[model samples]
Target: MKKRSFADLFFLLFVVYIVLPVVATMLYAFAGKWNKTILPEGWTLKWLATLFQDTAFIQAFGRSVLLSGGAVIIALLAIVPAIFVIVLYFPKYEKWIQAAVVMVYSFPGVILAVGLIRVYSQFGVPMIVVVLGAYVIGILPYIYQGTRNSLRNVDARQLLDAAQLLGASKMQAFRKVLLPTVYPGLFAGALLSFSVLFGEFVLINLVVGSRFETVQIYLMKKLSTSGHIASAVVFIYIVLMGILTFIIAKLTKQAKGATNV
Candidate 1:
Protein backbone atom coordinates (compact mmCIF):
# COMPACT_ATOMS: atom_id res chain seq x y z
CA MET A 1 0.00 0.00 0.00
CA LYS A 2 2.84 2.40 0.79
CA LYS A 3 4.56 1.71 -2.56
CA ARG A 4 1.29 1.99 -4.41
CA SER A 5 0.54 5.33 -2.76
CA PHE A 6 3.97 6.65 -3.63
CA ALA A 7 3.60 5.53 -7.26
CA ASP A 8 0.18 7.12 -7.47
CA LEU A 9 1.54 10.36 -6.03
CA PHE A 10 4.40 10.39 -8.55
CA PHE A 11 2.06 9.74 -11.46
CA LEU A 12 -0.30 12.45 -10.27
CA LEU A 13 2.57 14.92 -10.05
CA PHE A 14 3.76 13.93 -13.52
CA VAL A 15 0.33 14.50 -15.02
CA VAL A 16 0.03 17.85 -13.23
CA TYR A 17 3.47 18.87 -14.42
CA ILE A 18 2.54 18.19 -18.01
CA VAL A 19 -1.03 19.47 -17.95
CA LEU A 20 -0.80 22.53 -15.69
CA PRO A 21 1.09 24.67 -18.18
CA VAL A 22 -1.35 23.82 -20.96
CA VAL A 23 -4.31 24.57 -18.75
CA ALA A 24 -2.76 27.86 -17.66
CA THR A 25 -2.05 28.82 -21.25
CA MET A 26 -5.57 27.97 -22.32
CA LEU A 27 -6.90 30.06 -19.47
CA TYR A 28 -4.62 32.90 -20.41
CA ALA A 29 -5.81 32.81 -24.00
CA PHE A 30 -9.43 33.08 -22.96
CA ALA A 31 -8.77 35.33 -20.03
CA GLY A 32 -10.11 38.87 -19.95
CA LYS A 33 -7.55 39.55 -17.25
CA TRP A 34 -5.64 37.42 -14.80
CA ASN A 35 -4.05 39.13 -11.87
CA LYS A 36 -3.06 37.95 -8.41
CA THR A 37 -5.21 34.86 -8.60
CA ILE A 38 -5.02 31.15 -9.18
CA LEU A 39 -7.86 31.35 -11.72
CA PRO A 40 -8.47 33.94 -14.40
CA GLU A 41 -10.36 36.97 -13.20
CA GLY A 42 -12.56 36.91 -16.27
CA TRP A 43 -12.89 35.02 -19.53
CA THR A 44 -13.46 36.24 -23.06
CA LEU A 45 -12.92 35.26 -26.70
CA LYS A 46 -11.58 38.63 -27.85
CA TRP A 47 -8.06 37.32 -28.12
CA LEU A 48 -9.08 34.57 -30.50
CA ALA A 49 -11.34 36.95 -32.34
CA THR A 50 -8.51 39.40 -32.72
CA LEU A 51 -6.21 36.65 -33.91
CA PHE A 52 -8.58 35.42 -36.62
CA GLN A 53 -9.56 38.91 -37.77
CA ASP A 54 -5.98 40.08 -38.21
CA THR A 55 -4.88 39.79 -41.83
CA ALA A 56 -1.31 39.08 -40.80
CA PHE A 57 -2.29 36.17 -38.60
CA ILE A 58 -4.52 34.73 -41.31
CA GLN A 59 -1.76 35.09 -43.87
CA ALA A 60 0.80 33.61 -41.53
CA PHE A 61 -1.49 30.67 -40.87
CA GLY A 62 -1.97 30.13 -44.58
CA ARG A 63 1.73 30.38 -45.33
CA SER A 64 2.50 28.00 -42.52
CA VAL A 65 0.03 25.52 -43.97
CA LEU A 66 1.41 25.99 -47.46
CA LEU A 67 5.05 25.70 -46.45
CA SER A 68 4.50 22.73 -44.16
CA GLY A 69 2.12 21.00 -46.55
CA GLY A 70 4.31 21.61 -49.58
CA ALA A 71 7.39 20.33 -47.80
CA VAL A 72 5.58 17.18 -46.69
CA ILE A 73 4.20 16.58 -50.19
CA ILE A 74 7.55 17.07 -51.85
CA ALA A 75 9.18 14.76 -49.34
CA LEU A 76 6.50 12.20 -50.02
CA LEU A 77 6.94 12.40 -53.79
CA ALA A 78 10.73 12.44 -53.78
CA ILE A 79 11.68 10.53 -50.67
CA VAL A 80 8.99 7.87 -50.33
CA PRO A 81 9.89 5.96 -53.48
CA ALA A 82 13.57 6.22 -52.67
CA ILE A 83 12.94 4.89 -49.18
CA PHE A 84 10.83 2.03 -50.49
CA VAL A 85 13.49 1.05 -52.97
CA ILE A 86 16.18 1.35 -50.36
CA VAL A 87 14.35 -0.73 -47.79
CA LEU A 88 12.98 -3.30 -50.21
CA TYR A 89 15.86 -3.53 -52.66
CA PHE A 90 19.08 -1.71 -51.70
CA PRO A 91 18.90 -2.13 -47.94
CA LYS A 92 22.68 -2.12 -47.73
CA TYR A 93 22.47 1.59 -48.51
CA GLU A 94 20.21 2.15 -45.51
CA LYS A 95 23.23 2.69 -43.30
CA TRP A 96 24.24 5.67 -45.44
CA ILE A 97 20.79 7.16 -44.98
CA GLN A 98 21.07 6.57 -41.24
CA ALA A 99 24.39 8.41 -41.25
CA ALA A 100 22.87 11.31 -43.14
CA VAL A 101 19.93 11.53 -40.74
CA VAL A 102 22.36 11.56 -37.84
CA MET A 103 24.30 14.38 -39.49
CA VAL A 104 21.08 16.31 -40.05
CA TYR A 105 20.36 16.07 -36.32
CA SER A 106 23.89 17.11 -35.38
CA PHE A 107 23.79 20.35 -37.41
CA PRO A 108 22.16 23.26 -35.64
CA GLY A 109 19.51 25.21 -37.53
CA VAL A 110 21.62 28.38 -37.45
CA ILE A 111 24.54 26.57 -39.09
CA LEU A 112 22.28 25.04 -41.72
CA ALA A 113 20.73 28.44 -42.40
CA VAL A 114 24.11 30.15 -42.76
CA GLY A 115 25.36 27.35 -44.97
CA LEU A 116 22.26 27.62 -47.14
CA ILE A 117 22.67 31.37 -47.46
CA ARG A 118 26.37 31.13 -48.40
CA VAL A 119 25.82 28.28 -50.85
CA TYR A 120 22.67 29.53 -52.56
CA SER A 121 23.06 33.32 -52.41
CA GLN A 122 25.60 33.22 -55.24
CA PHE A 123 23.28 31.20 -57.47
CA GLY A 124 20.32 33.62 -57.19
CA VAL A 125 18.06 30.77 -56.10
CA PRO A 126 15.14 32.00 -54.02
CA MET A 127 15.80 31.66 -50.29
CA ILE A 128 12.23 30.57 -49.65
CA VAL A 129 12.75 27.62 -51.96
CA VAL A 130 16.00 26.91 -50.20
CA VAL A 131 14.21 26.92 -46.88
CA LEU A 132 11.58 24.63 -48.33
CA GLY A 133 14.31 22.29 -49.51
CA ALA A 134 15.86 22.33 -46.08
CA TYR A 135 12.48 21.69 -44.48
CA VAL A 136 12.13 18.57 -46.59
CA ILE A 137 15.60 17.47 -45.59
CA GLY A 138 14.95 18.35 -41.95
CA ILE A 139 12.04 15.94 -41.96
CA LEU A 140 13.87 13.11 -43.72
CA PRO A 141 14.40 11.14 -40.55
CA TYR A 142 10.74 11.27 -39.55
CA ILE A 143 9.59 10.13 -42.98
CA TYR A 144 12.24 7.44 -43.21
CA GLN A 145 11.52 6.11 -39.73
CA GLY A 146 7.79 6.04 -40.25
CA THR A 147 8.10 4.41 -43.67
CA ARG A 148 10.75 1.98 -42.45
CA ASN A 149 8.68 0.87 -39.46
CA SER A 150 5.64 0.36 -41.69
CA LEU A 151 7.69 -1.60 -44.22
CA ARG A 152 9.15 -3.76 -41.48
CA ASN A 153 5.67 -4.69 -40.29
CA VAL A 154 4.85 -5.68 -43.84
CA ASP A 155 6.30 -8.49 -45.91
CA ALA A 156 6.95 -6.09 -48.79
CA ARG A 157 9.08 -8.51 -50.79
CA GLN A 158 6.39 -11.15 -50.68
CA LEU A 159 3.82 -8.58 -51.65
CA LEU A 160 5.94 -7.62 -54.64
CA ASP A 161 6.49 -11.24 -55.60
CA ALA A 162 2.80 -12.03 -55.31
CA ALA A 163 1.95 -9.07 -57.48
CA GLN A 164 4.55 -10.05 -60.06
CA LEU A 165 3.20 -13.59 -60.12
CA LEU A 166 -0.15 -12.08 -61.04
CA GLY A 167 1.44 -10.65 -64.23
CA ALA A 168 2.20 -7.18 -62.86
CA SER A 169 5.51 -5.66 -63.78
CA LYS A 170 8.01 -4.72 -61.07
CA MET A 171 6.99 -1.08 -61.31
CA GLN A 172 3.33 -1.97 -61.14
CA ALA A 173 3.93 -4.33 -58.25
CA PHE A 174 5.71 -1.65 -56.23
CA ARG A 175 3.34 1.15 -57.13
CA LYS A 176 0.05 -0.67 -56.69
CA VAL A 177 0.81 -3.22 -54.01
CA LEU A 178 3.61 -2.30 -51.63
CA LEU A 179 3.03 1.42 -51.70
CA PRO A 180 -0.64 1.37 -50.73
CA THR A 181 -0.07 -1.35 -48.16
CA VAL A 182 2.28 0.82 -46.15
CA TYR A 183 0.86 4.23 -47.05
CA PRO A 184 -1.37 4.77 -44.01
CA GLY A 185 1.39 4.00 -41.57
CA LEU A 186 3.86 6.09 -43.51
CA PHE A 187 1.39 8.96 -43.79
CA ALA A 188 1.60 9.34 -40.04
CA GLY A 189 5.20 10.35 -40.66
CA ALA A 190 4.16 13.08 -43.07
CA LEU A 191 1.79 14.46 -40.46
CA LEU A 192 4.56 14.36 -37.86
CA SER A 193 6.84 16.09 -40.35
CA PHE A 194 4.24 18.75 -41.08
CA SER A 195 3.74 19.39 -37.38
CA VAL A 196 7.48 19.74 -36.88
CA LEU A 197 7.89 22.03 -39.90
CA PHE A 198 4.85 24.09 -38.97
CA GLY A 199 6.49 25.08 -35.70
CA GLU A 200 9.89 25.70 -37.30
CA PHE A 201 11.18 29.26 -36.90
CA VAL A 202 14.95 29.49 -37.28
CA LEU A 203 15.34 28.28 -40.87
CA ILE A 204 12.40 30.24 -42.24
CA ASN A 205 13.24 33.35 -40.25
CA LEU A 206 16.89 33.39 -41.36
CA VAL A 207 16.05 32.43 -44.94
CA VAL A 208 13.06 34.69 -45.51
CA GLY A 209 11.87 36.89 -42.68
CA SER A 210 9.16 39.49 -43.29
CA ARG A 211 8.69 38.23 -46.85
CA PHE A 212 7.21 34.88 -45.83
CA GLU A 213 5.37 35.32 -42.56
CA THR A 214 4.78 31.85 -41.16
CA VAL A 215 2.72 31.42 -38.00
CA GLN A 216 5.78 30.96 -35.80
CA ILE A 217 7.31 34.17 -37.10
CA TYR A 218 4.03 35.93 -36.51
CA LEU A 219 3.86 34.57 -32.99
CA MET A 220 7.41 35.71 -32.35
CA LYS A 221 6.55 39.21 -33.46
CA LYS A 222 3.42 39.25 -31.33
CA LEU A 223 5.15 38.12 -28.16
CA SER A 224 6.38 41.62 -27.41
CA THR A 225 3.01 43.25 -28.15
CA SER A 226 0.28 41.22 -26.48
CA GLY A 227 0.43 38.16 -24.26
CA HIS A 228 -3.18 37.24 -24.91
CA ILE A 229 -2.82 37.23 -28.66
CA ALA A 230 0.34 35.16 -28.37
CA SER A 231 -1.44 32.78 -26.05
CA ALA A 232 -4.31 32.62 -28.49
CA VAL A 233 -1.92 31.64 -31.24
CA VAL A 234 -0.44 28.99 -28.99
CA PHE A 235 -3.90 27.72 -28.05
CA ILE A 236 -4.96 27.38 -31.65
CA TYR A 237 -1.66 25.74 -32.49
CA ILE A 238 -2.18 23.27 -29.69
CA VAL A 239 -5.65 22.52 -30.97
CA LEU A 240 -4.35 21.96 -34.48
CA MET A 241 -1.63 19.63 -33.20
CA GLY A 242 -4.13 17.80 -31.05
CA ILE A 243 -6.24 17.15 -34.12
CA LEU A 244 -3.24 15.92 -36.07
CA THR A 245 -2.23 13.69 -33.16
CA PHE A 246 -5.68 12.19 -33.10
CA ILE A 247 -5.51 11.55 -36.82
CA ILE A 248 -2.09 9.97 -36.42
CA ALA A 249 -3.49 7.65 -33.79
CA LYS A 250 -6.33 6.67 -36.09
CA LEU A 251 -4.03 6.11 -39.05
CA THR A 252 -1.71 3.99 -36.93
CA LYS A 253 -4.59 1.83 -35.74
CA GLN A 254 -5.88 1.50 -39.30
CA ALA A 255 -2.43 0.54 -40.48
CA LYS A 256 -2.17 -2.14 -37.82
CA GLY A 257 -5.59 -3.50 -38.72
CA ALA A 258 -4.72 -3.65 -42.39
CA THR A 259 -1.47 -5.36 -41.60
CA ASN A 260 -3.27 -8.01 -39.59
CA VAL A 261 -5.59 -8.62 -42.50
Candidate 2:
Protein backbone atom coordinates (compact mmCIF):
# COMPACT_ATOMS: atom_id res chain seq x y z
CA MET A 1 0.00 0.00 0.00
CA LYS A 2 2.82 2.40 0.88
CA LYS A 3 4.73 1.53 -2.29
CA ARG A 4 1.64 2.02 -4.42
CA SER A 5 1.08 5.43 -2.87
CA PHE A 6 4.70 6.39 -3.54
CA ALA A 7 4.47 5.18 -7.14
CA ASP A 8 1.30 7.15 -7.70
CA LEU A 9 2.83 10.30 -6.25
CA PHE A 10 5.98 9.80 -8.35
CA PHE A 11 3.94 9.43 -11.52
CA LEU A 12 1.92 12.55 -10.70
CA LEU A 13 5.10 14.55 -10.37
CA PHE A 14 6.44 13.11 -13.61
CA VAL A 15 3.26 14.06 -15.44
CA VAL A 16 3.46 17.60 -14.13
CA TYR A 17 7.09 17.83 -15.17
CA ILE A 18 6.28 16.74 -18.72
CA VAL A 19 3.00 18.58 -19.14
CA LEU A 20 3.64 21.94 -17.43
CA PRO A 21 5.90 23.37 -20.12
CA VAL A 22 3.59 22.30 -22.95
CA VAL A 23 0.57 23.84 -21.24
CA ALA A 24 2.51 27.03 -20.60
CA THR A 25 3.67 27.21 -24.19
CA MET A 26 0.17 26.65 -25.55
CA LEU A 27 -1.15 29.35 -23.24
CA TYR A 28 1.52 31.76 -24.39
CA ALA A 29 0.59 31.18 -28.04
CA PHE A 30 -3.00 32.27 -27.44
CA ALA A 31 -2.00 34.81 -24.84
CA GLY A 32 -2.51 38.43 -25.87
CA LYS A 33 -0.23 39.52 -23.07
CA TRP A 34 1.02 37.32 -20.27
CA ASN A 35 3.25 38.82 -17.64
CA LYS A 36 4.07 37.93 -14.01
CA THR A 37 0.69 36.41 -13.29
CA ILE A 38 -0.62 32.83 -13.02
CA LEU A 39 -2.37 33.06 -16.42
CA PRO A 40 -2.52 35.36 -19.42
CA GLU A 41 -4.18 38.72 -18.95
CA GLY A 42 -6.02 38.13 -22.23
CA TRP A 43 -6.15 35.45 -24.96
CA THR A 44 -6.13 35.91 -28.72
CA LEU A 45 -5.42 34.02 -31.93
CA LYS A 46 -3.36 36.90 -33.27
CA TRP A 47 -0.05 35.05 -32.89
CA LEU A 48 -1.31 32.07 -34.84
CA ALA A 49 -2.72 34.34 -37.52
CA THR A 50 0.52 36.27 -37.69
CA LEU A 51 2.48 33.03 -38.02
CA PHE A 52 0.37 31.73 -40.94
CA GLN A 53 0.62 35.07 -42.71
CA ASP A 54 4.41 34.87 -42.79
CA THR A 55 5.69 33.74 -46.20
CA ALA A 56 9.03 32.79 -44.77
CA PHE A 57 7.43 30.31 -42.42
CA ILE A 58 5.50 28.71 -45.27
CA GLN A 59 8.64 28.33 -47.39
CA ALA A 60 10.61 26.99 -44.47
CA PHE A 61 7.88 24.48 -43.72
CA GLY A 62 7.97 23.33 -47.36
CA ARG A 63 11.73 22.94 -47.32
CA SER A 64 11.43 20.81 -44.20
CA VAL A 65 8.83 18.66 -45.91
CA LEU A 66 10.97 18.26 -49.01
CA LEU A 67 14.09 17.39 -47.08
CA SER A 68 12.38 14.92 -44.75
CA GLY A 69 10.10 13.39 -47.37
CA GLY A 70 12.90 12.99 -49.89
CA ALA A 71 15.09 11.27 -47.35
CA VAL A 72 12.37 8.77 -46.42
CA ILE A 73 11.64 7.96 -50.07
CA ILE A 74 15.30 7.53 -50.92
CA ALA A 75 15.75 5.33 -47.87
CA LEU A 76 12.74 3.25 -48.81
CA LEU A 77 14.06 2.74 -52.30
CA ALA A 78 17.58 1.87 -51.19
CA ILE A 79 17.45 0.21 -47.79
CA VAL A 80 14.21 -1.75 -47.98
CA PRO A 81 15.34 -4.00 -50.80
CA ALA A 82 18.77 -4.56 -49.28
CA ILE A 83 17.23 -5.50 -45.94
CA PHE A 84 14.76 -7.79 -47.64
CA VAL A 85 17.59 -9.59 -49.39
CA ILE A 86 19.66 -9.77 -46.23
CA VAL A 87 16.89 -11.13 -44.05
CA LEU A 88 15.54 -13.60 -46.62
CA TYR A 89 18.77 -14.94 -48.03
CA PHE A 90 21.91 -14.09 -46.10
CA PRO A 91 20.93 -13.94 -42.45
CA LYS A 92 24.63 -14.22 -41.62
CA TYR A 93 25.21 -10.69 -42.87
CA GLU A 94 22.60 -9.25 -40.48
CA LYS A 95 25.18 -8.89 -37.72
CA TRP A 96 27.10 -6.48 -39.95
CA ILE A 97 23.94 -4.53 -40.62
CA GLN A 98 23.28 -4.40 -36.88
CA ALA A 99 26.79 -3.03 -36.34
CA ALA A 100 26.18 -0.24 -38.83
CA VAL A 101 22.94 0.67 -37.08
CA VAL A 102 24.78 0.80 -33.75
CA MET A 103 27.38 3.11 -35.27
CA VAL A 104 24.63 5.55 -36.31
CA TYR A 105 23.80 6.22 -32.63
CA SER A 106 27.45 7.00 -31.95
CA PHE A 107 27.32 10.03 -34.26
CA PRO A 108 25.40 12.86 -32.62
CA GLY A 109 23.99 15.72 -34.66
CA VAL A 110 27.02 17.93 -34.19
CA ILE A 111 29.47 15.17 -34.98
CA LEU A 112 27.40 13.98 -37.93
CA ALA A 113 27.16 17.48 -39.43
CA VAL A 114 30.88 18.06 -39.07
CA GLY A 115 31.76 14.67 -40.47
CA LEU A 116 29.55 15.06 -43.55
CA ILE A 117 30.85 18.55 -44.20
CA ARG A 118 34.42 17.38 -44.03
CA VAL A 119 33.89 14.57 -46.51
CA TYR A 120 31.51 16.28 -48.94
CA SER A 121 32.56 19.94 -48.80
CA GLN A 122 35.62 19.27 -50.95
CA PHE A 123 33.53 17.74 -53.75
CA GLY A 124 31.68 20.99 -54.47
CA VAL A 125 28.20 19.41 -54.40
CA PRO A 126 25.31 21.38 -52.95
CA MET A 127 25.26 21.40 -49.16
CA ILE A 128 21.53 20.66 -49.05
CA VAL A 129 22.12 17.64 -51.23
CA VAL A 130 24.81 16.57 -48.82
CA VAL A 131 22.37 17.05 -45.94
CA LEU A 132 19.78 14.93 -47.74
CA GLY A 133 22.30 12.12 -48.13
CA ALA A 134 23.13 12.26 -44.45
CA TYR A 135 19.45 12.17 -43.62
CA VAL A 136 19.08 8.86 -45.52
CA ILE A 137 21.89 7.23 -43.58
CA GLY A 138 20.63 8.74 -40.34
CA ILE A 139 17.30 6.95 -40.71
CA LEU A 140 18.77 3.51 -41.46
CA PRO A 141 18.06 2.15 -38.00
CA TYR A 142 14.35 2.81 -38.26
CA ILE A 143 14.15 1.40 -41.78
CA TYR A 144 16.15 -1.65 -40.81
CA GLN A 145 14.27 -2.34 -37.60
CA GLY A 146 10.84 -1.97 -39.13
CA THR A 147 11.61 -4.03 -42.22
CA ARG A 148 13.47 -6.67 -40.24
CA ASN A 149 10.77 -7.01 -37.60
CA SER A 150 8.05 -7.42 -40.22
CA LEU A 151 10.04 -10.11 -41.98
CA ARG A 152 10.81 -11.95 -38.75
CA ASN A 153 7.33 -13.29 -38.11
CA VAL A 154 6.81 -14.97 -41.46
CA ASP A 155 8.78 -17.99 -42.71
CA ALA A 156 10.17 -15.74 -45.39
CA ARG A 157 12.55 -18.29 -46.87
CA GLN A 158 9.99 -21.01 -47.36
CA LEU A 159 7.47 -18.52 -48.64
CA LEU A 160 9.92 -17.26 -51.21
CA ASP A 161 10.91 -20.78 -52.23
CA ALA A 162 7.29 -21.77 -52.66
CA ALA A 163 6.64 -18.72 -54.76
CA GLN A 164 9.61 -19.59 -56.97
CA LEU A 165 8.45 -23.18 -57.28
CA LEU A 166 5.20 -21.90 -58.72
CA GLY A 167 7.25 -20.47 -61.65
CA ALA A 168 7.54 -16.94 -60.35
CA SER A 169 10.84 -15.15 -60.62
CA LYS A 170 12.58 -14.02 -57.42
CA MET A 171 11.61 -10.42 -58.13
CA GLN A 172 8.02 -11.44 -58.75
CA ALA A 173 7.93 -13.43 -55.54
CA PHE A 174 9.28 -10.52 -53.55
CA ARG A 175 6.94 -7.98 -55.03
CA LYS A 176 3.78 -10.07 -54.89
CA VAL A 177 4.15 -12.07 -51.69
CA LEU A 178 6.79 -10.73 -49.33
CA LEU A 179 6.18 -7.02 -49.81
CA PRO A 180 2.53 -7.17 -48.87
CA THR A 181 3.12 -9.33 -45.81
CA VAL A 182 5.68 -6.99 -44.27
CA TYR A 183 4.09 -3.74 -45.40
CA PRO A 184 2.63 -2.67 -42.06
CA GLY A 185 5.99 -2.88 -40.34
CA LEU A 186 7.60 -1.08 -43.27
CA PHE A 187 5.00 1.69 -43.13
CA ALA A 188 5.58 2.07 -39.40
CA GLY A 189 9.31 2.47 -39.96
CA ALA A 190 8.83 4.96 -42.78
CA LEU A 191 6.54 7.10 -40.63
CA LEU A 192 9.00 6.99 -37.74
CA SER A 193 11.82 8.01 -40.03
CA PHE A 194 9.80 10.89 -41.49
CA SER A 195 8.83 12.21 -38.04
CA VAL A 196 12.45 12.13 -36.92
CA LEU A 197 13.81 13.88 -39.97
CA PHE A 198 10.98 16.41 -39.99
CA GLY A 199 12.06 17.77 -36.61
CA GLU A 200 15.81 17.65 -37.34
CA PHE A 201 17.41 21.07 -36.86
CA VAL A 202 21.01 20.63 -35.93
CA LEU A 203 22.46 19.09 -39.06
CA ILE A 204 20.59 21.38 -41.46
CA ASN A 205 21.38 24.54 -39.51
CA LEU A 206 25.03 23.67 -39.27
CA VAL A 207 25.34 22.58 -42.89
CA VAL A 208 23.39 25.40 -44.56
CA GLY A 209 21.77 27.92 -42.26
CA SER A 210 20.54 31.08 -43.96
CA ARG A 211 21.06 29.57 -47.38
CA PHE A 212 18.30 27.08 -46.62
CA GLU A 213 15.94 27.96 -43.81
CA THR A 214 13.91 25.05 -42.46
CA VAL A 215 11.02 25.43 -40.01
CA GLN A 216 13.45 24.83 -37.18
CA ILE A 217 15.78 27.56 -38.39
CA TYR A 218 12.82 29.88 -38.72
CA LEU A 219 11.81 29.07 -35.13
CA MET A 220 15.29 29.94 -33.93
CA LYS A 221 15.05 33.29 -35.64
CA LYS A 222 11.65 33.92 -34.03
CA LEU A 223 13.11 33.28 -30.56
CA SER A 224 14.86 36.66 -30.42
CA THR A 225 12.01 38.54 -32.10
CA SER A 226 8.87 37.38 -30.28
CA GLY A 227 8.19 34.92 -27.50
CA HIS A 228 4.57 34.51 -28.51
CA ILE A 229 5.41 33.48 -32.04
CA ALA A 230 8.02 31.03 -30.80
CA SER A 231 5.51 29.48 -28.46
CA ALA A 232 3.07 29.09 -31.34
CA VAL A 233 5.74 27.38 -33.38
CA VAL A 234 6.60 25.00 -30.58
CA PHE A 235 2.95 24.24 -29.92
CA ILE A 236 2.41 23.42 -33.58
CA TYR A 237 5.47 21.20 -33.60
CA ILE A 238 4.35 19.36 -30.47
CA VAL A 239 0.90 18.82 -31.90
CA LEU A 240 2.39 17.46 -35.13
CA MET A 241 4.67 15.09 -33.24
CA GLY A 242 1.73 13.91 -31.17
CA ILE A 243 -0.24 13.15 -34.32
CA LEU A 244 2.63 11.20 -35.89
CA THR A 245 3.12 9.28 -32.66
CA PHE A 246 -0.54 8.29 -32.62
CA ILE A 247 -0.40 7.05 -36.21
CA ILE A 248 2.79 5.15 -35.59
CA ALA A 249 1.19 3.45 -32.58
CA LYS A 250 -1.81 2.38 -34.64
CA LEU A 251 0.39 1.04 -37.45
CA THR A 252 2.65 -0.80 -35.02
CA LYS A 253 -0.36 -2.38 -33.34
CA GLN A 254 -1.70 -3.45 -36.71
CA ALA A 255 1.65 -4.98 -37.62
CA LYS A 256 1.65 -6.97 -34.40
CA GLY A 257 -1.85 -8.20 -35.09
CA ALA A 258 -0.82 -9.26 -38.58
CA THR A 259 2.22 -11.03 -37.19
CA ASN A 260 0.10 -13.01 -34.77
CA VAL A 261 -1.85 -14.36 -37.71
Highest lDDT scorer = 1
| lDDT by residue for model 2 (1-261), tens | 999999999999999999999999999999987787899999999999999999998899899989999999999999999998888778999999999999999989998889888999899989999999999999999999999888887877888999999999998999998888889889989989998998899999999997999999999999999999999989888888899889999988888887685
lDDT of 1 by residue, 197-231 (tens): 99999999998998999999999999999999999
Q: How far is candidate 2 from the true structure (C-alpha RMSD, Å)?
A: 1.4
What's the TM-score of each model vs. the native? 0.95, 0.95
In candidate 1, where is summed lDDT lowest over 10 consecutive residues? 174-183
Superposed by TM-score, candidate 2 places the C-alpha of residue 169 at a distance from the truth, in angstroms, of 2.5
